[model samples]
Target: MHGCFWHRHPGCPKATTPATRPEWWQRKFDGNVERDRQQMDRLIAAGWRVGIVWECALGRKADGALIDRVEAFIRHGRDLRAEWP
Candidate 1:
């Protein structure tokens, strides 16, 4: 699972930048995003499905339904790419 802050999940409140070092943080986040994209691309090219499960989705109080969804994806999902809420 990827941390929402590090992966910069769109519209996620956890994806926040520190006020002290805006430029540095942006560069770091950008690098992380780029690396993730490149890795996913490579995996896709190798004929492997990819799924991103944000850390926030598996909260401290994770439920059975969410676990089932993840399990289902791993077992039978056909999509090349998917992101969990």
Candidate 2:
């Protein structure tokens, strides 16, 4: 699992580009996203289950159900996804 901004988690509030330097921020963010994608791809290909748990998904309201989703991915290799309702 990874943080939203650093890993470019979809729909994350913190994943926004800085307004002051839009171009630079976009490039940097794009690179971060690309790197994460490549890393996930490699891990999956190597038989390791990988996932991204966005920060937004860990909000107060979603606390209880998150564990269930994580357990499912870890135990059964079910689709590794966790997001806010």
| Local distance difference test scores for all models | 0.91, 0.70
lDDT for model 2 comes to 0.70
Give one digit per residue, the lDDT tens place, for model 1 in 1-85.
Answer: 8999999998999999999989999999999999999999999999999989997888678678888987888899988988888
Q: Write the per-residue lDDT of candidate 2 for residues 9-59, one digit (tens) a residue.
A: 666677766679888878888898898878878887887767667776676
* Candidate No. with top TM-score: 1
Displacement of the residue 52 alpha carbon in candidate 1, Å:
0.9
Error of 1 at 76 (Å): 1.5
Where does candidate 2 have its weakest 10-residue lDDT segment? Answer: 76-85
The number of residue pairs in model 1 that clash at the backbone is: 0
